[model samples]
Target: MKFLFIAQRKLVILRNQDFKDINPERQIEITRHFGPIHIHPTSGECQGGSPSSR
Candidate 1:
């Protein structure tokens, strides 16, 4: 199954983690353990410096 996760204000697609097999109660518990996902900003090309600087 595919899951849509919002990370850093972006939509990320997650697939095939066997989420369906787990019960609803356990699913909520498992999801709470997940940390904040960070996604790089997709703007222009990065030069010699870090992308975050740009």
Candidate 2:
């Protein structure tokens, strides 16, 4: 196995974004447009492909 890491030196903060005030389903829908959401390895087993849905 191989491991890789990068030190991120910059960050972008989106203020007043509607994403913070939406339901889980809607949030997941929007996030999907960008890429697959990450689920922690230790989060336990999720029935579907990802834990994005409760």
Candidate 3:
């Protein structure tokens, strides 16, 4: 769910260097509420973050 969403975002970022502005922590929060498919326009990709759950 949330984890998956974050994974998706991370993938997007990896693909687009410009998406580095995405804050990993903030993305986690969004994923917590909106699940993993939340897309962020600024990053030009889905809202996602670290999947480590660390």
Candidate 4:
């Protein structure tokens, strides 16, 4: 699942999962294809001035 990777990138990595060491910008590029990324409520503004969905 795509969400698993996104969450893993922030939280913990599970055994047997392929880990990617990507920069934030590159991460966005990869994830954008899955649709808009979710930002935390307190994270403030994201790329292009888009506010957090929360």
Candidate topping lDDT:
4
> Could you tell me the lDDT of residue 29 within candidate 3?
58
Model 3: per-residue Cα lDDT at residue 28: 60
Q: What tens-digit string does per-residue lDDT give for candidate 1 at 7-54?
A: 445555568688776764565556556653233676544334442332
Clashes of 4: 0
lDDT (CA) per prediction: 0.50, 0.58, 0.52, 0.60
- Best prediction by TM-score: 2
Q: What is the lDDT for 44 in model 4?
A: 74
Residue-pair clashes per candidate: 0, 0, 1, 0
Structure candidate 3, residue pairs in collision: 5-36
Supply candidate 4's per-residue lDDT for 45: 68
**Candidate 4 C-alpha lDDT tens digits along 1-54:** 877877877643457744266545666676677677777777776445553332
Which regions in candidate 2 have their CA more than 4 angstroms from the true location?
1-12, 42-54
Better of 3 and 4 by lDDT: 4
Cα displacement (angstroms), candidate 2, residue 17, comes to 0.5
Candidate 3 runs further than 4 Å off = 1-20, 36-49
TM-score for each prediction? Answer: 0.36, 0.45, 0.27, 0.39
TM-score of 2: 0.45
Cα-based lDDT at residue 32, candidate 1:
51
